[model samples]
Target chain A: MNTTSKTCLLLEDYLDGQLSKPDKDSFTAHLAECDACREQVRVSEKVRELFNQHPQTGLSDDADLRVRMALRREQYGKEPAKDVMNLEETAAWLGVTPGALAERLDEIPAFEIGGRIRFSRKRLEKWIEMKDGDILLQLQQSHLRKDNNLLQFPGGKHGKQQSGNSGAV
Target chain B: MTFSDEELMVMFAAGTMAAFDMLYERYRHRLFRFARSCLISVSAAEDAVQDVFMRVIRSATQYRPGYSFKSWVFQIAANCIRDIGRVERKMICRNSHNDTSGLEIDDRSFHVRRIVAANELDQYLKVLEPDERMLLILREYEGLKTETLADITGTSPGNIRVRLHRIRQKLAAGRSAVDREGEI
Candidate 1:
């Protein structure tokens, strides 16, 4: 083929903006002179316009949440969240007796599948997160009451404390 | 600090759900657009995108930081769409032979009118094989580089460029042309 025909064949890459700078410049120079190639470029640009106008459908507002949930389910299902635990397992995870846990079942987040109470490790985690702060606060206050030093001694009375926890502290 | 897709992917492998979430947020819409364009049916396209993410997390541990994560997930989506297309094609074959009425959901004509009646390219896309259609979508619409398209499609860049040229020629032949003497 002649040079013009060869350049005409580069129309796809030219319109795609894939050509290197010099090649693009040459193609641009060629487009100015070549009628067939310019017309082809116009049609290709129209094709591009069609692509631009394709109207991407159904990426609804919840698509992220939807796919996210789907991925979560897949990940959880594959990894086995081991998150949902039976009453006995949940009690074991919580370091409580099953009987003790049953007393607090109403307070804990749980669901009954087939009449068997199960707890989500996720919900349990959040529950622990909420209550652990209070538990920690209570423990800190109890320690503070014993020491009476947290306020009195801005610097902790580390040496004055002769408790068994002296080494731990 | 903002992380690259590859960085986020590596972080995701290290068990950061936020990294995965970031990856999801970046890709969900783009993947949906590609899937919707090629798969035609909205539900199938959505399922394909969901399937892509599922595969992403499932294989996130295997993702290397050296590769482009965009290419990685798109390859997964492309494979997912191809798999769905294969099953649908078989059903279409059976449905065609049996003249089945109930399975028309997968019918190209029905879906063309329902979902893509207005997109002029969709008609031309109908004539393309799935791979060619995907290649065109990735290259032209998605603005993926020839090398990235190569990586996603598992072909050489030269092969991609050649295919793109041929596909464009086919599309131009199929589309109404600009007049030789007049402006577009």
Candidate 2:
């Protein structure tokens, strides 16, 4: 079968019984004739099962609190007095639309709990600085590049000067 | 009930300690796991996590709102682990090839099974490079998305996916070999 067909068959939809009737039929037909596809299905299923069996490891309660306390003291230079702004609130504080902020969610590191995104305040703050630093770095690089180009050609005025000097000499 | 991650970060920058605590509570375990997986030592992992938080604390004042806090923290953790691993390898060059053995297996349901399985898998993992092992663990154990995995590892998602596929194939082949020997 074609790459597209193979991809469709390999997708979660095909495995999860979410595929449309015709698509499912096509995938099964292909699987019936293809030993490789059949093996892939088995492997995928095993992988899923193994992952499910692998329990999620978590931090100790005290360690969790310690980490937070450390971060608080480190970032703000003081003990935490209250909960900070959340994802939505941060987006609002940045003066951008929520969609715009959400678009860059991947750029921000986060953990999802029941569909809600949780962020590290310390990390987020650093990220914001790094982003601004990146912008500044880019602007500097662009300006440097422009200056280098000008130095290389000195362009119209320099060209005119060189020609005039050559003529006078 | 509590402020969200973004809110905490904003509050953190604005000088609230509570927000910092919330963020720490959220990610400390994952970061510790990521660190321990790489360094293979509890002490080293703890140190790495501490360093990561320190960096975050020092850098919080520079935070921008739109960026992903998860990606940023993972990136820092990855870097911290990488640096620590490098130092560790250099300090104990003779022990560089030692296998990873300290992964805490506490699931009582499959205590024996997990022990045996982890032993078998640990051997195979030892054969791979540190970066490769990290890639596999992040993808398999952490269940991070390809994009987020890429962001953490500093590779393109396409590259991460291809690497993961190759690693999975290798692991499967190894398992098959073990099965043939009736070891697992």
Candidate 3:
């Protein structure tokens, strides 16, 4: 490679102080001769300096503590804080096959500790409650759909009953 | 005696809380800052940092000592930040004046100018795509070696070198523009 083109390749390493003695020597020699390269080196150095100069940003003290606590909770699993059921126990309690429950382990709110997955009774109950809510919503939507269908077919028994009630009124 | 990060990772893999704590103490600040730079919000950064450590905890047994712990940990953090960015879809810049007051100064740059320039730097960073921003932050701010960056980014070191050159050029242009404005 030509000396100038080669020197350009060394700029990154030179700026990072990663160049070896021989390479550094040659790079500096070229820098002394080439003002453009010299200016580029100066600007690159200044740029790195500017970035390095900015203040060290870190999480706040409380944030650090919170993160540590959260990690500890994750590693230990949430079972220790309350009554918990192991995978088999939870599976039996839910009346599902162990293999089937294992398939839905992610869908269930469970924690893994010591390579064993455990389910928190409280959280599982809450999750079940949420699931029940979802079921209720689906039932309501299905009922609404049925009612709309019956309303559309006014000759149906339900629609005739409604029409008779309206005529009597 | 202080354990190497990889050694700590091994101990942590064996469920040693002390080792995990040591790792946390060593990396909490740097990782938080790394996340903050990427997510651009203190709260989001906080969440991302916590998620990163949680991932480490979850995957402790799966970590192989063959790799650099630093790169592995940062790769996890970068993934966490990207996940949060995708889910949140809102990148918030720190209120430079309010948030910058407590950072430990590394150089004697004029404080006001540094703040303004740093804010401008954030804006430019936000303009780039998330992956580019992560690449720049990891290389420039975190001072990760090119090899380590390549390891974390899953790219060749040669590719990292080329990309870093372009990133530095952008940073240099932004710095010059901000400096000129300060003079004006």
Quick one: RMSD of model 1? 14.8
For each candidate in turn, the TM-score is 0.64, 0.56, 0.63
* CAPRI class of candidate 2: incorrect
Per-residue alpha-carbon lDDT of candidate 1 for residues B1-184, written as tens digits (9 for 90 to 100): 7789999899879976556766776787888888877764566677888888888888988898889998899899999999987776665553222232322245576655544434446555655788888887787788788788889888897787667767766766655443332353
Which candidate has the top score in lDDT?
A: 3
DockQ of each: 0.17, 0.09, 0.17
Model 1 lDDT, full chain set: 0.65
lDDT of 3 by residue, A2-114 (tens): 33476777776776789999999999898877755665566456545656755545777556545644564465453343477664345435533334455556677898776
Local lDDT at B64 for model 3: 98
lDDT of 3 by residue, B1-184 (tens): 8689999899878865567767877788899888766664567788998998989988988999867999999999989999997765554444453466433345656656667666655655544667877887776677788889999989998888778766655655676677798899
Question: Using TM-score as the measure, which candidate wins?
Answer: 1
Better of 1 and 3 by lDDT: 3
Q: Candidate 2: where is the Cα deviation over 4 Å?
A: A1-57, A60-73, A76-169, B90-114, B180-184
lDDT of 2 at B37: 61
Across residues A56-164, which tens digit of lDDT does each residue of candidate 1 receive? 5445544443454455445445554466776534543554433445555677889977656678999888977988756434332332122222211111233123222
By TM-score rank, best first, the candidates go: 1, 3, 2
Q: Which lDDT tens digits does candidate 2 get at residues B32-72?
A: 87776677555677778888988888888777775678877
